[model samples]
Target: MRNRHAKDITCTILLAALAVSAATAATAQDGMGDDDGLAATDLDLSGTDLSAIDLSGTDLGGATRLKPIVVEARKFEEPIREVPFSVDALPAEEIEAARIRNTADLVGRVPNFNFADTGLSFANTLNIRGIGSSSALISPSVNYYVDGVPLPARVFDQRFMDVRSIEVLKGPQGTLFGLNSQAGAVVVATQDAVPEFGGEIGVEVGSHGERKLDASVGGAISDRVSARLSGTLYGFDGDIRNIVFDGAGNVVRDDKSVREQYSGAISAKVAAELSDGTDAVLSLRHSRSRERPTTGVWLDDPHFPRNAFAPVPETTTETTGGSLEITHDLGFATLTSLTGISHYELDLEADLLDGFIGGAQTGLPPFAFGAAGANVRRIDETSSQVSQELRLNGEIGDRGQWVAGVSGLYSDLESTTDITSLAMANGAYTGRLKKTNLAAFGEVTVPVGERLRIIGGARYTYERQQFGGTYAGRPGGAPGLAAFAESQESTFGFVTGRAGLSFDLGPELTVYGTIARGEKPGGYLFFNQFASIGIPLTEFKSSGTWSYEAGLKGSPLADWLEMSTAVFLNDTSDEQLFTFNPVAGRFDVQNADTRSYGWELTMTARPTESWHFGAAASLLHAEITSGNALIKGNDVPYAPGFTTSLFAEYRHPLEIARRAGSAFGRAEYQHVGSRQIDPANSRRLDAYNLVNLRAGWESDSFDVYGFVENVFDEGYTTSAYRAGNAAGGGGVFAGIPGSGRALGLGARVRF
Candidate 1:
């Protein structure tokens, strides 16, 4: 059945490609001049009054072209269509219309991107081409950056505000972005301070008691300085229910997995122009969020599909950071420097066992109490990072462009965990981890001819990791095992590189191919208390991947139509795999050999001035080529076999409104294929479809909009876990369900 579906999709894509080619060829053949193609005409409009002519609704037939988008995810600026990799650029207007708030909102919009909500904000995960970090302590395979400053994985869930653009770069980016970018990168650019004084404010109301407020203000403070500030606040009530009863036989009405939450962020930036053609920008931001974390519900229990027995599950996060960026231009080269520091903290408490013990103890005496039956877990963690980078960029005559840079990073992290029950206790576990990284990288691009170019880059990195921690037994346990402290350190280094060739077929077409190698450093896994006892924990070895890709991109019909397609094969060795250890009741990291091959297609068309359309699809086949028996032939977790999306928008002039305005509507459809949840491939999530609708009216100074998400109210799971002995004597399957249907209304005003 899967084969049949795959064949059908392949055939459809080929047919679409042929049709587009035919149309382009026909349009090219229909020339409007003589056979010699040297026809010319003279116009006598010297006495014509151009101001009296109305051109508001004129059909220019693709004469007025759309501006080309530039991408900066490669640490350099290049036109998106000419880049030798898969990239997606989303402008601010598109983000607003799509109602994108966080990483979770980006899935399906970009090819091969997926997100899983693990109930806790800090535990949520993102996957690109089946590569992601499963443990919170480990760096993500896909890195995220905001205005050139790297962000921690835990903060990926924060709400976006005053964003100017977002660029998604797929495949390995190690040569330019360094480690932790083995899979890809996401770059977010925010609005900068301008010399003009202006501001905007918006308010939104939605179902489930949702409310949001966002605003931004910016202006010039003096001839040499300009400043800007932006902020956002959002909150909503959850929809899940808790039906379990307490020990007093009274019904517990407190809703579980409720979204009752409040989160806000404020960012300020100041730019100064100094003498000697130099400039500097200082930025500061702070954010705080508190929410009732989602709780997992038993998959076998049909009576409470959206309900959980957990009584107390909550999480709170706080982040503060600042950065200073300076730039100077020399006669032959430009120099840039960036320095930044940030601190992040998270506190979470959840009922791990839920009601497993309560239900099992129904038929037994109430005397059973000890560490062996604990049902609750609480965690607190904090981390701080400081980073610095300096770079020089220049052009070699007229045929080449080059860049070289050096970067350094230092980070410190601390965490504490407590597990206990009413009558039993598992002593607290405390740990501290520190790391330092240094790197130097260089890249150059040279034109071989008028239509061909060659590009190459490489980076060398060195890292050192130090860990110290202690594990303690219950208060009444043996004195020898009551408490112990241990420390360990390790150092490693590696080099990664990329090489590519690109050719311009015409003014509107580009073809490119690239070969790149990406690497990610290894670190110790301290979650396993038993493994940390008596000796230093062994660090997992680093992992690497060699990727080969070929792609074609072009606007054959100019602004009327655009298309891009790419195929890639990635061979990975010592692939990092995260697995649950039932015996240890924790997660552990291991190494495996794997392979991933995939193809992606993206298209956009604006056949008419008032109508626009877009479509993107991805097909992947990723598996463990050689590994342990449990994973050797299994599919990579979280990677679907295929995914696709389609969207259309239309706008029309509104002549009956209070002032000059336009009305627009949009509809989007997305499909996500079935996916596995573990290396063993014993659990799978079924395929799901979603549809969204949005409509709005806008003018120069004001706008109003309404939207409906999950129009059909489909039910599905975003994440799942299987508990063997941890859930008592029998195994239990639990999962976090996806959000249900919702509607929202909003308005915005600008001055």
Candidate 2:
């Protein structure tokens, strides 16, 4: 722990020195906000046409004060104060200032948002309000979207290079979005075509052979048309040290895979004014990643990647999608039509006892699996989806607003897995699934008076799904059955809704309460390892959750400090968990009832023009209320007890090449409490703390910055599961190690 103490001391000294330098500066130069005035009251909206105002730049950070912000989160543009819920909107400025490279960075910035980084970007999972599944294949409580199209898990981990805005809505958002959002939703809007010719180019290089090049170009093509094109290419060699050990349990050597992974993505879009009252936009995107996958490590020895033997598997993933949206004005109302399609593919070739499962398996010694080279695991997966929706939005003179929509979706998934490991009895599995869904949803807000409002919404959905798969059995050392193929289909119908009340104590404060129901349809999982035996294919039932929340928001300390607080309780039934089967493969699935209660706080302060602070905290308690009697009271898997983030930044003027520029130093602290990794409570991931530091200088046209993440090099694990390397290592566990200390430099230019 001495090294940890030293890191803390070093961080303290550096930050103290920077703060001192800022305070003792001879002069301070005005920044972008100097003339504009950073205060909310100082905003000047005079002479601007509210009807044509942009909603993409809305700042909904604190519900502390009610401002006339037009936000487009409910599939319709509306005043932020009237939403009567929790929503955090971060535009391009905040994205750039925070140096948020990917969706994972959003965890600390928002209360109750959690991300589990499983080393494989494509396999990460997002959770909100202490609710998440142990595996990625299950129906997610929280969903992700880009523009208006839902993103499959295979591409949800893509980098955010040309993002324009991101909006996070907490709690059940089933009525507000088109996707399967049982818990919450994250919506991302990439940079769109601008009326003027403009773009940016950026380059970044960091440790572990990290290199990135991203660029974007956009301009008006005609009086009524504009187009934009953006792309990003990045590569990272492996950082985890793979150690080879002898029978004596001693590390003998290290394996390094340098310059072995790369990824690239491109997005293109065009916007047009078809007529005086009509507009349309079309967008397309493609992304691909080819990498030597990071096999996991032992949780107790995260820094020492023992038995992460290779020839490493080469995992390749690709995603392509397109979307079109059209809007028309009908005098008293507006009509919108949207259609989208997406395709995803994954190809993985791995080893059973070595490169596939990290560290240990079945609690057996790592050296026992030295000859696992003969055991191979190969998988190929493909998925595609098509969605269409039509909605109408309107207002009632001086009363309130309303929106209604109808949407339909169709999707297909296919996968094949072959495992030659002796532990699995030399088996293979293949599966195919198809789903079709249709739904109608509506929401309305009615003003009860100048200080009070009532909001209500509901949705009715019909779903049908079909699944089929086969297991190739081997009759050998383990019991086996004849190879059999089976197919099953299921149908479901459900209704969900939300109701709320909001009272405006004044222009600066509001109190609100809401109760909503969220749900996920039940379906068949084609590849259950247990089903390979005499067990029949079992279809899980649908799940539902009722969330009740009450909160207060406002600027209690006047214009400089803004804060919000909320308390919530959730009751759920049939929550699904997909995980590794202790005896064989990774497709084990189950369900349980759960209860969770939590309180959250978010604050932002600008005590002075040169200093800024932001903080958020989420304290929660979640437990299984029922289902399996053995662990009925166990804490919900992967649901941390608490999470928090604190941030501070100081800005000062600097003389660069005889020109005035801004220099800034920023510090951030984030923490996640410990939690169980499985419903059975056989394994757990300990709490972890991280410190990140950043410093930079920038002008209006360009910026240069450097950052050090995980400055303390704290050892942690992002995920833990049953290990496959051990013979009978059921009690022992292995995990995907979290990132270590890494520093990097970056530069960007805008024209």
lDDT of each: 0.74, 0.74
How well does model 1 score by local distance difference test?
0.74
Colliding residue pairs in candidate 1: 238-259
lDDT of 2: 0.74
List candidate 1 segments past 4 Å from native: 1-59, 62-64, 254-257, 356-374, 397-399, 422-425, 476-480, 529-536, 581-586, 725-731
Summarize candidate 1's per-residue lDDT along 152-203 as a digit string, tens digits.
7667667888888888888888887885788888888889999899999999
Question: 359-421, model 2: which lDDT tens digit per residue?
Answer: 344444555554434557778899999999899999865857899999999989888887666
**Inter-residue clash pairs, candidate 2:** 64-554, 361-723, 361-726, 362-728, 362-729, 362-730, 363-729
Kindly give the number of clashing pairs for every candidate: 1, 7
Q: What is the lDDT of residue 60 in candidate 1?
A: 39
Stretches off by above 4 angstroms in model 2 are 3-70, 243-253, 258-260, 301-303, 355-368, 371-373, 473-479, 579-587, 724-730
Error of 1 at 75 (Å): 2.2
